[model samples]
Target: MAESNCTQVTEFTLTGFTDNPVTQVTLFLMFLLIYLVTVLGNLGMILLIKVSPQLHSPMYYFLGNLAFVDLCSSTVITPKMLVDFISKKGIAYAGCMAQVFIYDLFGMTEGFLLATMAYDRYMAVCHPLLYPLVMSPKCCFQLVTGSYLIGLTNGIGQTIGMSTLSFCSSSVIDLFFCDISPLISLSTSDTTLSHVILRTSACLFGVSSSLVILVSYVAIISAILSISSAEGKRKAFSTCTSHLITLSLFYGTVFFVYLKPSSDSSREDKWAAVLYTVVTPMLNPLIYSLRNKEVKEALRRLTKIK
Candidate 1:
């Protein structure tokens, strides 16, 4: 009986932002512009890092990978979301599950990458003499590969937990994109195990990574304070200011959405989702390039060569 009921929901109707034609058109145009900028900006960052000899360092290497992740994360959701604004927003169960898995994959990877970046920054600031040895090419590659591996594991676990449940209730998800909370609300079977999986993964990836960032920054700050000159202090802080901003933006909205109970999720949660999912990717390149002198110089050099 449960199997038959679960099989009944082949498709889900997404209750997107608005039903008004004018509003939809307006939002569609806005999101389209954002998506275009996101694609161009992240791609430009990656290309600049690739071609610029000045950017051939451990820092920029990680940065290039970050741009790739941001580009992919935005592409996964923004195109479908833009289409939903114009047409009837319906998604097959398989498609929805795919979205959930990919979304979780990128989301978790981004968090781990941020923590890795924090550790990189800490090494650079706190141990300048040993930075090259400690953060060698092999080490950096391993860190990034580990981040993706962890993300892949979490994605598989979450998707399996979600798939085992029976969505026999209503087929309407009250968000712009598919997420664990909304899907859990629609399940007819007991979701205790699923919730446990969700919370456990959240702690394992989210909270643990956050702790890594916190500890790294604390040591970073201590080392910066030990600098004898004001100019030296300023330079040290400047190196990480952009990363600090990006981390705050990404984690702020993520924690707001995921840390709370599903029953507590509301329309406000959707808007918060928009921040990390859509807006953060768009802003990452801007924040990094605008704030970092090295990136700006690389852009100028590349433009002259072109």
Candidate 2:
């Protein structure tokens, strides 16, 4: 009966990137450009990988999936955020939850997929003789399946956690979109369990995935150094450097945002979100393709396709 005292809030007012009209306009335009480029770039990458037989390896398979994740993740957050900037009102509770769920799905998938990619790279570079046996199509498929399994588990768990919390009071979320932290803050119900769940989820999905990638790369770097031929070493290093760069940027921002305690004035949180959600997606195709002559050639051939 005491729990019935809770009031139900239908909508949430978003305190967007900035309250300043000028800043909002500027951010809107900038993010619009970022979103457009992210879509074009990731779509193009996926298409290129799909069409090119040379890109049919486990590495490219994961890269294509990564592109897919980036595209979906950006779609979840950026467009609505853009609308929020232009429109007077913001997102509703249901809409926010839907976005949050999808965002969690894609983001969590990306983390797991990246770790899987690292393992793929580890086999390819560290044990080239066994690469064929290790990275068979079935194995690759299993890896990708495992990633989605993790993503689904995380998404459903978080979504349900969010759903159980009653947002009966102020629904104004002080962010561009509804995130777990802000949503938890808005809930009228006690969020102790929710917070613990979220923190545990973060560690399981985010930190654990990053650790797997880190360890895989550590082994990879060692293997690269052991190559006696300078040319062999150069080629091996080049193949992985771009991936490592993207990995660093993605995980760095993610760890900074999720692993740390929340502070309202934390510019790092906003910037980290931008980095992982907007900037990373836009940059992935370029980073992966520019370093990959095969991908560049594939794009060239794709453009020339009649």
Candidate 3:
């Protein structure tokens, strides 16, 4: 029987947050409402960016792409989570693999895309004279395309690596979705290589992209300081406040959940998952719209037109 289970984990149960009847129903309703807002906010941001002529720039272009990624990521993770909450919660092996691939596809893409946007901002603020030529529409497309391709490659590698492993023991996943870390922890097979590969790849994708964003902000700050007028400096810095806040919120939760020293606590990690997987996507559009004058003005114009 052990050998048979090793050959294939036909189905894996998800030990979602709670099993209490009332608590489960309450959690289900809450998550459903949050998922709806996430969808609407991300989709609305994309639609507004598309229709507003004033937003036809590299910044807005990248924002639309970010919104698309957020929307897809939330959709990929949340609906299935909701289903698991309300019904028998078991996913086939293939289904779990698909979840990991799709979730990482967007998650990694967003990491690199945020770095790309930081670079965009750096060029715009620090190298204004050369920004037009350096960050041309073609370059924007290539950057976004390259980020997606990298994410695709990462997702494929993660899926293939996961498929190679065999699960001979307990097949219960103690998380909301098919997070790679928790899934690997449940594996009975020797996972030394899998752990190394996942850790290396996560660092390569997460830390490297974060480094790029950090360097870009350094340059942006230097440029902002060089400005002669106080208002000019404030204007330059204000544009980045929203992105900075988003970056902090994202990296903070992810680092805590995936990279921190105490990350082995799966019970605590589920609530952290709620943060990045649930809360962040819903807050993104609101953050950008409320913090950005351009987005707010465009939204006003759009409302008046309607």
Using TM-score, rank the candidates from best to worst.
1, 3, 2
> In candidate 2, what are the lDDT values of residues 1-306, reduced to their tens digit?
646987778788887777788998998999999999999999989988988998999999999999999999989988888887878657878998898788888889998988998888888888889999989999989989888888888888888889888977687877777889888877878887777778788888778888899899999889888889999999888878888898888888876776676664475577777888789989988899888888988878878953
Rank ordering of all candidates by lDDT, starting from the highest? 1, 3, 2
lDDT of 3 by residue, 1-306 (tens): 565546567888988888898999999999999999999999999999999999999999999999999999999888998998889998988889999999888999999988998999999898889999998999999999999998898888888778878876778888878878777887877787777768778778878899999999999999999999999999999989889988988888998887756446757788888889888989989899999989989999988854
Worst 10 residues of 1 by lDDT: 1-10
Q: Model 1: runs farther than 4 Å from truth?
A: 1-7
Q: Evaluate model 3: give its lDDT.
A: 0.88
Better of 1 and 2 by lDDT: 1
Candidates 1 and 2 compared by TM-score, better number: 1
Candidates' C-alpha lDDT: 0.91, 0.85, 0.88
Consecutive 10-residue window with the lowest summed lDDT within model 3: 1-10
Q: What tens-digit string does per-residue lDDT give for candidate 1 at 214-243? A: 999999999999999999999999999999
